[model samples]
Target: MDEAAGSPAVSRRIAPQRASLRPWLLLMPLLVFLAAFFLVPLAQVAMMSVTEPEFGFGHYASIATDGFYLRVLADTFATALLVATCCLVLGFPLAYAMAAASPNMAAAMMIVVTMSFWTSFLVRTYAWMVLLGRSGPIAALLDWIGLPHGELLFTRFSSTIAMTHILLPYMVVSLYAVLRKIEPSLLRSAASLGASPTSVLRHVVLPLAAPGVVNGLTLVFVLCLGFYVTPILLGSPREQMVAGVIGQQIEEFLNFGEASALAVVLLASTLIVLGLYHRRFGLDKLWG
Candidate 1:
């Protein structure tokens, strides 16, 4: 009986069990960290949304019915859409250039594109304030051209431009990853088959690059919805985004319930955008 208990069959069974548990053991730390820091705080905020001020869903009800909250929600979605579009428009050409360049040149261009990440957000925001001020280089250029550049500092245009600049790197990197993987032979074959440059791009390049475009657009749009600094500093006070309103409610009114409700709404909106993307195209291709 003792020899049978220590037999090779028993060892094999035990080894498989230990091997199967290894991955979960390795992931235990990360799981614990997320549960403690992220899940706990999120659960607290969700609880506060209904429990604060009263044990009811009045804050969410107000958000659904109130004109100011509805308008802010609309504005936030619109602004996110605009920024995502702008990033795509501006980043695609640059990313194409990077993909088409020599290795050294591509690396240099990538460095230029990614340099913005090295700067702190506050510093970049301040730099924009200086550049968009009445006496900045852009205004000076307009002055030289004898064109009026009225109020470049605090407007939707400024906010949009700044957000576009900040988010452009993400779009470019996404496109470049997919574009770099394209086979030159395919493009050559299209051209060899009498396809015009535009036709080749329309038929071959864009389709292959679609995954990257979707990834970039989704990433930038979700990020823009939660943007707090650039819009607050550069945007018009009247045209407040949901994030700005959330901050204002917490800081000024001490309205924890309203702020928590707004935060939950913003998180839900982001998740909905991602879910739609996943439904259309599997999320596994998000990296491309």
Candidate 2:
């Protein structure tokens, strides 16, 4: 009887896994909220993708076969890639400067970089409209320079410039986070070893900053994929992105199933990109 009382089975029975459930119990409210809001809405979207017009995958099939749908998807991806590349090219130098600056200077620069967040993106979009308008500063400058100023507003160039400006901060912040962690001593050491400035940057700086680059590009690309307002307002009417196409389907045509299918495709594409990145570098290292 005494041996049985102290047995492992007895111990397990006494505990009854109650302690193990405490953390889950604490998390139940958050889990329930997510299920009620996010999961339920997403499930509805998925269902509508197949079932709204009738219980069929006709919308997806149409999307697969339609040249318009394919072109929109291709354009969306190309725009996202362009925005990401532009942000990287412009942001890297600014971030490097911030990382190399004195603490006071860096803090000031960071404040400036992050100031865009304080304003509404819609407002910023309108501001771009004003700036790119026919008699705007850019056109005025061109006029002053004796150059022909073609239409800047309602063009791909306007949209690309607006998106790059809007998304530049994300890239800058990501690169700054990584670049700031790099030790000045290490750079000095590399220089002391007879490594040229360019070589040190190419080998040491870039490799260390690669994670930040990937993180920034991923963020900008994914966010740009679903961009609606800026693209619609600033982009060329002839070149419609997937998001714009999805909105038009729902708003103009009242075709929820088609819109839902487009949304699902966009979501799946985003997930695939994230999955590939996770497989290559692991998602946890994104912010590191």
> Model 1 scores what on Cα lDDT?
0.93
lDDT for model 2: 0.93
What lDDT is reached at residue 27 by model 2? 100
Q: Write the per-residue lDDT of candidate 1 for residues 51-156, one digit (tens) a residue.
A: 9988999999999999999999999999999999999999999999899999999999999999998989889988899999989998999999999768998888
Clashes of each: 0, 0
20, model 2: CA deviation in Å? 4.1
Span of 10 residues, lowest total lDDT, candidate 1: 279-288
- After superposing candidate 1, which stretches have Cα over 4 Å from the reference? 1-10
Error of 1 at 69 (Å): 0.8
- Please write out the lDDT profile of model 2 over residues 1-288, one tens digit for every residue: 878767977788768677889999999999999999999999999999999889999999999999999999999999999999999999999999999999999999999999998889999999999998998988889889999867999988999999999999999999999999999999999999999999999989999998899999998998899899999999999888888999999999999999999999999999988889899989886655
Candidate 1, residue 1: the lDDT equals 83
- Write down the worst ten-residue block by lDDT for model 2: 9-18
TM-scores for all candidates?
0.94, 0.93
TM-score of candidate 2 against the unseen true structure: 0.93
Estimate every model's Cα lDDT from 0 to 1.
Answer: 0.93, 0.93
